[model samples]
Target: MMRSIFSAIIFLVLTRVVYAIDPRWGQGCTYIDRTEQIYCFGGEPFSENSQQILVYALNITGNSVLDLSEPQWTDIPGDPNGIRPSAASRFTFTGFPGTDTFYIQGGIVCTSCNYNSGFKYSVSSNQWNQTNKNKPVVDASSALVNDILYSFGGQTSPLTGYDQSNTTYRNTVYYINAKTGADGPSVKPQNETQLPPFTWASSMVYSYVYRSLFIFGGKQLSATEVTASMSDITVVSPQTGVYSKWKNIRSTSGSLPPARWGHSTIIDSSNRTVVMFGGCNDSGKAMNDLWLFNLDDAVWSPQETTGTPPTPRCRHSVVVLGKYMLVLFGGNDGTFNSDINVALDMTTWKWTNAPTNILPSDSSPPIDFPNSSSPQGSEGINEGGDSSSNISGGAIAGIVIGSIVGEDSSSLCLRNETDI
Candidate 1:
């Protein structure tokens, strides 16, 4: 009898020792280097055969060290009385540099409509306050540079259909004041200056090295044709005036990744390199391939990673920590997943355990923009050289095959689930 009790106790302890993976999708997340905490806002708790989509304004934080080595997840509930942001997905959740506050921007409400409302959450106060201004709602990718939040190339509200090109894709660039989280003056360049192609679901990263924004892999759509420019790397350098210089970087060799959307791209300040991970390819397939772009050399290199890598997915959130480790969180792989809390050590190009001694010192921005601003030399031509002409305009019909159960290729909104 004593032996049976001891065996039962051992079984219970073993089960308790297993790591926990949160199940969610379409969450807005960002990492605060100062506090070493990752904040994720509203997300849809996903499951196969689940009809009801529950979006919660739950602030999920990974405290202490999210080194991928025994990382911890905590639910920091907001004040019950404070007005919370509406439950939504594909919203922009980003943090301001040098502060403990993070902002949540426009997102799609559960009923498939988009909202332009804005709210700011204070980690220190544990409260959420609505922003004073509301901008035009969009399904765009945004990045912060010098206190300004620039949203590029996303469809505006009243989402028609995911695969439709005529009214769905946008090349409009919206500039919002990061201070008040409100719309600002037009930053769009003149018709003569190079402009980025009309695209949505693409990822954009600001490079302090060149004072430019690098965009990669989103479905580029146009009327009359559905072509995608997955091979070219578009760079938009914002200048002092309204006119920003745009250029496309083509791979001199064959190491560049194919056209994909819903991928995550982040910059490594230490080396002036951009790391890109999985996204849905043009053929409606999820990829787990990893590639690195040497910003200095203007070269693309495929990373040969070892150890257990995360499963193939898109719409996942990633943040670089310890200056070398890239930590990844929730995403979708045919189905929604919250169990992915992994890291890639860029130094060794290996998928190894997080080093306990390596605590990130620099206050890296929420989106992995390098901490330094030293000018790295440029390779492409200047302002007047329009790169938009290089884009082979056309949209691909049925570009994304829904991997989630009960979802078909024709389902809009949820098909391109947004992430940070």
Candidate 2:
């Protein structure tokens, strides 16, 4: 009888240790070099609504460890009555240099409602503070350059009502200072520029080596039709109080990934290359391919990888740790959400799954937000202004087959799915 009880207790302890880890997708992740931790905020479970803000600290003795074991997640405490940003996706999070504060700006609150407000979170205080509320409501591409937050093309809410398909798409540029914590005058910027039409969901990464921002695929729409994927690569350099004109990059080597939005791009300043991965095409099928663009030579090349790659996904968050390691977490696979975390070795172009462990007893549960739903419907660039709806199973099958053949072939037609 004593042996039986001891065995049962051992089993329970083992199960608890294994089950302590929680997986999530669609959350925004950023690495804090000061804390040697990665902060992840706001995600969806199985494509449903979830509001979780947690941090994971690396298990390294010092800064010399090359391979890192998966760190446990700890919930950050927020003020009970203080202002907090509503849970949302497609937002941009930029950490201020030499500080523990990070800023979240412009995201889709609902299928038709995009937010214009900005919020800041201090890692040291574990609190959130509302900043500017008058910023443009955009689900667009943004990058931080020289302590200035620059937001580019995205869609605006329609004045006529909740028409998701007929909203206005913008290529205008706006900037705001990152150090200010108030929402009043300091949040607004006088620097603004109008450019050619560019749609939402594009990805941008600032290259300090080149002193410019590189923009990848986004969609373009008109009253009658939408261009689902864009092939042109645009580079913007911000000058004193203004940004230079958008310059299209001419590729001479390998083919570009099918025009896509909801993808991620990160710059490795040490290698002088921009790494891109996983986004959906017009047909709404997720992708798992990897590609790299050499900034010095202006060449795009497909990366052949080894080991297991994350499943095809879109709207995921990725951060480069140190110079050669890239960590990607959480995303939608078109039909469902993913909680998988994967790491890539840039030197060898190898992929590996991140290790997970049980959470400690001191960890807290994520704070819940009220009245939030799974965000649906694509933002900006609706093809034929169709009503936002889920893609039929038959349409999804066709997309998979089309992707297998070729994105530029006649079999593939640019289509929009419900937004991520």
Candidate 3:
């Protein structure tokens, strides 16, 4: 089944002009623990002029043990009378905790244009409603905490056909009320004078143990200079909607991972660590190395993961389900691909194209909600279930730095300015 899926993906890439089943790249996806579904939206399709306008859902767990190699996928349409959001790529897609609603923000609309408007979607109503205009950002990273969504640095202007001469990169931070769609006032660290770099196409994840957000590698573009990739880490505490300050944390023990952009990251609360994987390196080549960041001591350690890993690629999405399983989806590797790769057992650091683990049959989810303070204390879950699972889990969408198609028929490259 895995081989067949790969074969079909290759065939579709060669023969199909439109990507309806799985988007090419730059689409965001998040897993809904309550519904046991993964929702994806807004990506560039195979046809350069086309976009993925529909929402795609994939079932992560089933009635009993399931084969992840041939997972089930479904497409959902918005309400007929509602105004659906205009199609764009590399936008932020995140679920509002304790609700069925998801919010989407700015993205690339054309080679020279970007959309700064926001949109809200409800899974129960199957609807899409345009909200207030959001901060102008494409290829940015975001995370939701206590009903508020915070977005980090990204491109504010569309790339001028691969040239950064006229492009604008922002170091500003933006926040919004996920439930009310009300924009939060501009925020700055109360105690710090410096802010995070003007970064875009980076990966970010929130740590429950530390009560802060960790942002890693991406292109750093400023008026004075342009750095291809960076290896530093920035941590910010958005305490109850207002930020306290930003701190730079660098590894002091060992060699750090090569700086890269368009990567994916997830927090492992059980181990007090952050896991990072595959991205395009500074030399414009895709990489598949895995690295772990120890939150306790600020050290970097490389992991020799077992099993044949997915092909090296960048601009992919990754999400943690249950306690230890990390599921990875579509990415761009010179060519766009639609494939599912899994780190089936994080404790053992094993990778697989096929999975045999069975989801719990009880009414409760297999992972713990990140916002809850104690077992069975999560705010918005249904009345009764085995709410005691201690595993840390949250929705993390895949991120891309937006893409620009080369003039040639076969080449698709990252937004023409950068090497990758």
What are the lDDT figures for the candidates, one per model? 0.51, 0.49, 0.55
lDDT of 3 by residue, 327-354 (tens): 4455555566545545455645677765
What is the clash count for each candidate, in the order shown? 9, 3, 3
Off by over 4 Å in 3: 1-20, 46-52, 63-65, 110-116, 159-166, 190-193, 223-231, 240-253, 324-326, 341-343, 357-420
Kindly indicate the candidate among 1 and 2 with the higher lDDT.
Answer: 1
Q: Model 2, 302-388: lDDT tens per residue? A: 778997777778777675442233444544544544435566655456776543221111132221112112111111211122112
TM-score of each model, paired residue for residue: 0.70, 0.66, 0.72
Give the winner by lDDT: 1 or 3.
3
Writing each residue's lDDT as its tens digit, candidate 1 over 62-147 gives 33333454544545545656666656666665766557677776655544333546778776566778775454344467775545
Model 3, CA-based lDDT = 0.55
Order candidates by lDDT, high to low: 3, 1, 2
Worst 10 residues of 1 by lDDT: 396-405
Ranking by TM-score: 3, 1, 2
Worst 10 residues of 3 by lDDT: 404-413
